[model samples]
Target: MNKIFETPLYPYTHHPDEDAETPVRHKTIVVGAGPVGLAVAIDLAQQGVPVVVLDENDKVSFGSRAICFSKRTLEIADRLGIGQKLVDRGVVWNLGKVFKGDEKVYEFNLLPEQGHKRPAFINLQQYYFEDDLVARVRELQEQGAPIELRGGCKVTEIDDCGDYVALEIETPDDTYDIEAEWLIACDGAGSPIRSMMGLDFVGRVFEDNFLIADVIMHADFPTERWFWFDPPFNPGQSALLHKQPDGVWRIDLQLGWDIDKAEEKKPENVIPRLKQMLGEDAKFELEWVSIYTFQCRRMEKFRHGRVLFAGDAAHQVSPFGARGANSGIQDAENLAWKLALVLEDKAPDSLLDSYSDERVHGADENILNSTRSTDFITPKSQISRTFRDAALALAGKAEFARPLVNSGRLSVPCAYDGSTLNGPDTDALPARTRVGAPAVDTPLGQGWLLDRLGGRFQLLTVDADAPDRLDVGGIEVERVAVSAAGNETLRERYLGDAASGVYLLRPDQHVAARWTSFDETAVRAAVAKATGRDK
Candidate 1:
C-alpha cells in the first residue's frame, strides 16, 4: 500500500564543533532548506562558494503546496542544473480554461510559441521539488563541493558585523554559534529570521479565507488548469482545480470571511464539499487540507548589511499568479551570482544593494498583480462584483473584456524596467527580449540557448565569430557562435536580420549589453555597471 504521508525529506546530519571554543565559520550560511534556500545554496556551491543550509524540519513540505513552477523559473532551475529532474517529475501544463457556471468563457493558452524547451508551467508537489534540489546538493557534496545541509536546526539569533554576519543556531540537543561572511534567509512567510530582525511586511491583505486541499485519486480529469468564478459546485465563491504529480489533485475553494478554519478543514466538513464538486460516487482519499488567508506583502529591503533575504523571506504574493515561489527562486538566481562575486572580492559589496533594488521591483510587480487578481476574484464591494460579473459575462462573447477577466493573471517573468544594472538596448530587438530581460531560450542545434549561457559570463556572437575572449577583472568568458540556419530563433531574438550582433550575457543569464560588432571598452563598462560599480 502507498504511504499515507509524504516522506521526510532531509534527515538530520551531525556537524562537529570547530576546535572546542571557536565557532565554525562559513563563507555563506543559508537558513531554511526549502526550494528557495536549496537553489541559492546549489548556485553558490556550483560557483565554488561553501554554504551551510539550516532548516528546522527534516520533512518535505507536508502537503501539495506550490504546485505550479513557471517557465522562467524552470529556466532558472536549468541554470542550477536541476531543471530536467524537476520537469521529469512534474505534470506539464499550458492550457487553462476559465468557466462561469460551466459555461466556458474562452480557453486561454499560456505558451503559444512552439519549439521552446519547457511548457508554461509544471505542477509538482513542493515536497518533490525540494527533494530533487536536496538530491542535487548531495550530488554536489559527493563531487566535493562545499555545500552542507543540517536539518532540524533553528536559528536563534543573528548579529550583523560590518563585514560578516554571525548566527546562533539550536538543534534539538544543544546550541551552537556559527558565523558567515554572508547570510541568506529563505525562510517562509512567517520567517523567523525576518521576525528576529523586526522587519515589517507592508502591503494589502484581502479580507477573505481560502481553503486548499490535496486529493489523492486516479481521476479522469484532463491535465490542465481549470479555474471557476462562482462555480455552481460551490456557488458565490471562486475555486481552482489543478492536476499534480503522484496521482494527486489540488483543489482550492474560497470560503468567505468569518468562518472557523479549524472546523472547515475537518474531513467531516471538507469531504462533503469534495463530494459536492466531484459528485457522490467519486472515490478519493484526502491527502491534505488547510485553510489560508494570504496577504500580498514584502520587506522594504531585501538586503540588510551582510544578511540577505530570498524567496518567501523577501516577498510574498497570492498563489493566484504563481508568483511566490517562482519569484523567490528568481531572487536566488539574481542574488547568488552577485553574492559570489562580492565574496570573491571580484566586485564591490555595493553590488549587493542592487539585489535589494532589483528584487523590490520584482516584488512590487508581483504584489501589484496579486492585488489586482484578488480584487477581481473577490471584489471588495457589490459595485466591484457587478463590474467583474459584467466583464466576465462579456468575456464569454466578446474579445476585449477577456483581458479584464482576471481570474488570475498567471505568472510571467518580471522585466527589470529601471534597474541600475540594466544595459542599453542595441538596435531594435525583435524577439521581445531586451537587455534588462532574462535571456529568452532559443534553439541552438538540438540544445537550447539558455543551456550555454548560465553559470558564467558569455559573449554570444550571432552569425559572427572570433572576438578575442572578452575578459574583464579576472572574469574569463566563453564565446558561442550561432549560425543563422541552426539558430533561427536566436537570429530573430538577438540579431533581427542584422548581419551580426554581440550579446554580453551575465552569469545569471540576463543580457548585459549588445553591439553590432565587438567593442571591448563598451563591454567592460557594461560589466562594471552590471556589477554595481557605476553608481
Candidate 2:
C-alpha cells in the first residue's frame, strides 16, 4: 500500500456541536470527502460560505480508482487552485491506439490543436487527486475560509425539514445531530443519503465484469492509452492498458458474466493471466486489484428538496469512457456557484433548479455515450459482435469506418444547448463559443483567457466595445477586452468571420450568451436569464 493511503489526513476529532444543548445549524454541509465533495466545499468556502464536510473514513482512497482526468476537468481544477499540481504529478497523454487481434488498427489524438494551457488528459491515482484537494482545503483554512472537514463522521439518518436538512452523524466517541440550510451529498455510488431519502437509480446494469489490476512495474510501453479487442493473450475479450505515475500501470481484462470472481482474484490465477499478457519474464508487484460491473444509471433528479446530490451519488456511467470522476468533478463546479448565489440571496432559490436541470442534461449525455461504448465493447449478441468486428476491421483500411470503431468514445464537456438559462446566440461567431458551450481557452498577451475569467460572471469581448463593468440585477460582470488583430487563435475560436464578438460567461466559465456586438440591455437580460430570474 502507498504511504498516502496509510496516513490519516483528516482523522476523527470531537466537535463542539456534539456537546451542544441543541443542534447547531450551518450554512452548508457536504457529505463525503472525495474529489467532488471537497471541490464543492472549497468553492463554497472561497465564496464565503461556511461549509462542513463529513466522511466515514480518514485517509485517502486505497487504490488508484480514477486514474484518467480530462482536460476539461483539469481546467475546472485550475479554477479551484490545484490543476497545476495534478498535471505536475501525472502522466500526460493525448494519443490513444486501438488494436484488433494481434494487429494495430489505428490511432487518434484527443487534442491535436494547441493554444490550450492543459493537455488532453492526465493519468494520476485517485489518492493523489484527493490528497491535493484536501491540501487545498488546508490552505483555504489557513487563510480563514469557512470550511471544516470532519472524518469518522458517518451519516446515519437524514431528514429534509422543508427549509433545512437535519442529519444524524456518528463519530468514534459519540453521535450527534446537526442541521444545514442546504446539504450536498457526494457519498459515492452506493449513497446512504440517497437510500435514506427512498430514492433509487434508474437505468441498465449490464451482465459483464472487468478485472482491474494496478501493478507497479518498470515497463517500456509508451505513454499513451492502449486498448485491445480480442487480443492474443486475452482471447475473445477486451483489454485496456494505461500508464500512471510511480511505475503503476492499470490493466483491465474482460471477465465473462459467469465466472468465479473470488477465485479469479486469487494471485495464483491473476499472476498467470498477467504473465500471459506481459510475457513470462515480466516482473511486477500488485498494488491494487478489484472487479467492477458495468452500470449506466442516474437519479431521476439531482436536487431533492433541501438536499442536493452531486458526483456518484447522483449519477453513474460505465468507466470505459473515463466519465465517472470527470463528470462528478464537473458536477461540483456546476453546482457550487449556483448554490453559493442562492445561499447569499443574490439569486432566487429557483436558480438551484437549473443546477438539477443542467446537470441532469449532462448526466444523460454521459449515460448515452457510455451505453453505446459498452454495447460496442461487450456486444450482447452475435449480430452486434459481427458488426463491431467489421467496424474494427474496416477502421484500418477505411477512414470513414474509424468513427464507427468505439473503444470508448472518450469523455468531453457536455454543452447545455437546450438549457433554460441559455440566452441568445449569434451564428456569425464561432459555434464552439456559442450559447451554453464551455468557453474555449485562447492565449492572451501574458496569461490564458480561462485564467482571467476564473469562477465569475464576466463579459469577454474581442475587438468589440463594452463597459469595463456592468451591474446587472446585483450581479457584477467585469469586461475582459482583447484585440483579435494579431491573435489568430482568438479570431478563429471566438470571432470566426465576424469582426467582433461579445460573450456573457457564467461563473462556471460556460457561455450563457454571445453576440457579434455588445448591447447593454441584451447583456442585462442575459445575466437575468442565466441566473434563473428570466421568469
Question: Which predicted model would earn the best lDDT?
Answer: 2
Residue 150 CA error for candidate 2 (Å)?
Answer: 0.5
lDDT, candidates in the order shown: 0.86, 0.94
Writing each residue's lDDT as its tens digit, candidate 2 over 1-535 gives 5788899999998999999899999999999999999989998888888999999999899999999999999999999999999999999999999999889999999999999999999999999999999999999999999999999999999999999999999999989999999999999999999999999999999999999999999999999999999999999999999999999999999988998999888888899999999999999999998889999999999999999999999999989999999999889999999998898788899888899999999999999999999999999999999999999989999989999999899999989999999999988998888899999998987889899885789999999999999998778999999999899999999999999999999999999999999999999999999988878
Local accuracy of candidate 1 as per-residue lDDT tens digits, 1-535:
2242346566666678423488777899999988999999999999999999899888777777788999999999987878999999999999999998778898889999876898899999888888889889889999999998988789999988887888888887688888888999998888998988888798877789999989988899998899999998899999999999888899999999899999999999999999989999989999889998868999999999888999988888988879989999889999999999988888899999989998999999989989999999999899999999999999999988899999889889877767788776666554466787788887777788788778888888876765657677877777877776655666777778688887888888887777777777887888888887776
The C-alpha TM-scores of every prediction are 0.97, 0.99
How many clashing residue pairs appear in each of the predictions shown? 0, 0
Worst lDDT run of 10 residues, candidate 1, spans 1-10
Please state the error at residue 529 of candidate 1 in Å. 1.1
